[model samples]
Target: MASTTVADGIVDRLIDWDVARVFGYAGDGVDPILAALRRKEDRIELVTARHEEMAAFMATGNAKYGGGPGVCLATQGPGAIHLLQGLYDAKLDRRPVVALVGQVVSTALGSGYQQEVDLHTLFKDVCAQYLQVAASPQQLPHVLDNAFRTALATSSPVCVIVPHDVQQAQAPEPGQQEHGIVVSSTAYARPRTIPDVDDLESAADLLCAGRRVAILVGQGAAGAEGPLREIAERLGAGITTSLLGKPLLDESLPYHCGVMGHLGTTASADLMAGCDTLLIVGSNDPWTEYYPAPGQAKAVQVDVAARNIGTKFPVDVALVGDAVSTLNALVPLLPAQAGWRPEVERSVTAWREVAGQRVAQRPSRLNPQLVVHELSEHLPADAQVAVDVGSVTYWYARFLRLPPGVPAHLSSTLASMGSAMPYGIAAKLLHPDRPVVALAGDGAMQMNGLSELITVADRWRGWADPRFVVLVLNNGDLAEVSWEQREMEGDPRFPTSQAVPSFPYAAYADLLGLRGLRVEDPARVGPVWAEALAADRPVVVEAVVDPDVPLLPPRQPEQKVRQTLRALEREAEGGQAHELLRAQRAHEEAR
Candidate 1:
């Protein structure tokens, strides 16, 4: 009988779970696993990443795009530490992923080992399950199975730490008796929860009583798009989305109000404020102020997680079930109400017109909104977008209208910078035939490991089709933080937020053997985008934008305005009157 090492057993289990790829960097601690992977290279491919953080991000992206648990591997200590940011991104976003971490040899675990760290304690907050595989080889298969199962069942990351010595130990023989050694393929089941008949009736009654109804969607409502649209139409309701749920429905729908919250649309805010009944479906929008004030509107919430129901607001009726199933059940019981449809249509039209004006205005420097607007117009029907966190996210969220079926990936809950590029890479690897674009800010593009661009070039060089584009809004500063300083803190642009050295990102792309285009003129935006999109290789389009352009929220609170005015008064007294005047001009331009 052939004997297999624990590393080989782990690899075999991953293959059985249908994991076609793993992302990571090499290190001494993981050499045995690497050797086992090399032997099984034909079955599972390894994607070498420039940074361990990017590797974790790539795995998260894969889970987001591939509709399964993303897998990543990292070595002991520092390598594993670098994965925390990306792992946290997955945990917060509710993406299923499995991270395999290497550890020091079992005997040297607490002997002041060079690369030993208490990984369980370190990863406690970021993972749903943190397990260290036992030294015995017989324990490998059970640990691997549990790790994958927990990740999928909970829709969160799971970490399995393997000591270097354990990885090299021989597995039990094929015929050996073990308690949990069943090798047959087992299906990972997630049974859908259906709401009780009484609960559905109560929810329907609430909707029927209110004349003006509004629906709020989130990530949990992804598969329920058709059902949501149907229910919204049947009830003559206006629909708005949480930031993460923006792409659940096409924005071009007549009754669809864009996004709601700090980065929301005026129409959506107005719709939510005026509605007599609010139906929140599968969203846990943390911004309490954005929802209808307590006692202002009755609410009915539907969510699969029982804990999430009524967590954000007071729900008169709570339906606990899968969104698609619950929505379908509730729709049949709702009464058609056309009385509120016309008002919603009028509000949506007016909102779009005002939004159009903002995107149309030409500044002294190229406007970031216009760039996103043009990209939206030029993209293919099936194009996928990966948006970074910053001011650029504001434009993408507002300007880009994702048609139904086109996926848009973002670090929404975590709100992390530098996710765009890695997301784009993973999306392209999953759907090489489709067009993928990463919309990012200059600061975010630099922070989250821009060196991964070389990884893209190297991986896709020989591919038959590679259509990935990174569009950097190069404003030469952390524009979002600068805006926050002025708006939230009532402070002038301080050195901490203002000084970011401009780098030629396009030139850097060129050095990495990918197509690169630089656009300083607004007139060249369309042409450059066209050229870059048509390229057979991965491309970078760096569009220079005005740093002075302020990112104003759709609806500014009255208190915020008062604070800004008071800050301006303070600045005027400090012999910085010119700065106050500049702030006023920028605010006017944004409006």
Candidate 2:
């Protein structure tokens, strides 16, 4: 039998940490590690992606859905550079990810050899929490243990660079103690934190004093849904979530206002504007303009990280603790404000009416909103959802009503495009028994989604339940940026810049041996979704939607509306879009 090499020991340490998969691409720089992975294939699987960037994204997705430290591997230079985007995604979204990057031979250091870019400078920002270069064979478990530990403890990405020569070196014998040897174990447990009595009391007192209470939640508030609901009930408060927090809470709650931001519902805007007390839980949402005006509400912010508190909004009381414990501790001290419930309910009711109107509208082409709205009824309770960034994100935020306990994730902070396909693949691979739904726009589909589809086609055969459904909104335009130019800059749609190249996404799916369904008429939207969800194999549903339908922000100001109307008037075929914008703005005003 071959003696254990450092690369083999690295794989062993990963297995010790219960890592079932490591997403990556192969390169000669990491040949030794790839060999070890092949030898230990039974214990840990290597998931290869079309690009190193997608591999990193798969790892980030693994962390998001699996609730563990996700691991990814890559070769030197270009491979390391490609991992930055996904690592930044993990960092901004606060997910734990560990990147095992391969480096050039130790002898090649500072020789300016081919593919010898500085890996440290490239990863320093994305892996600010923990970054190290494994210099010797004996550092095997020590470097990996700290990488995993720091990633989990900080809920961020970490990096470990292993030189090619070091990976080929013989691993030190077990229990061998030497002056230079360092030993470490893969043992980590999340701390159960609760705020001190004084802080909890102060928070409770502030909450009790408000006649109109509003609560904002983010991803950090996950797993504390029960306590959150109970507290909302006790305080008669309205709850709104950041886009990241949408999956954690049930939208069916009478007092629940959907997401809060530019793409958020009118109910969330009303909730923020009308509240006297704001309770922010585990959310550092950057949409400060959508928040209640300064001095409009006395705020109490709760977060596990102290730095996050009061950073987004001014807080009178800061509760540094986990969401569940913090909310539970304040429950006993908060008194019921039954009078505020009616106002909160009114906002939710109006929002429902507006959303229904928008989805039911008959635009020149099929409405994108209608496509996502139809899924609410057919979506499986066990399905996982991955959404891409673009106008599709707006539709998803407003229209899709995810079943309670069904997990959905998106690149919220980084807002990266071409993320849905990779994320859906990761989620499906992790829980092959559950179905996955990915929503993307035409622009995102062309960016990288098209290439990742081949990865999906290759892997679906192994899935226990091969119901991976991808919804591609084919509008032939970069609708989000088009609207932003009109609204933000008072500029007309720049066809040269915003128009997307037409592609037959559904036909391409059929070519790959996957079921493909296309719906151009509004009447076929629901049936297409039903067919896709029940298909024997993975399916791609292409909905040809109208780009003219407005992505108007909730409670859009008169000045911006005027600007958008002026810009629309200048477009060659903007009359329909202009009329739609006016109607949307009128509906919001009516509410």
Clashing pairs in 1: none
* Residue 175, model 1: Cα distance from true site in angstroms: 6.0
Candidate 2 wrongly placed segments (more than 4 Å): 1-3
lDDT of 1 by residue, 492-515 (tens): 667555667779899998999888
**Inter-residue clash pairs, candidate 2:** none
RMSD of each: 2.9, 1.0
Q: What lDDT does each candidate get?
A: 0.83, 0.93
Q: Which candidate is the best by lDDT?
A: 2
**Residue range 1-591, candidate 2, lDDT tens digits:** 334999999998899999999999999889999999999999999999999999999999999997488888999999988999999999999999999999999999999987998898888999999999999887788999999999999999999999999999998886567787876787788899999999999889889888899999999998889989988999899999999999999899999999999999999999999999999998999999999998899999999999898998899999999999888888888776684888899999999999988887888999898999999999999999999999999999999999999999999999999899989999998999999999999999999999999999998999999999999999999999999999999999999999999999999999999988999998888888889999999999999999999999999889989999999999999999999888887777888
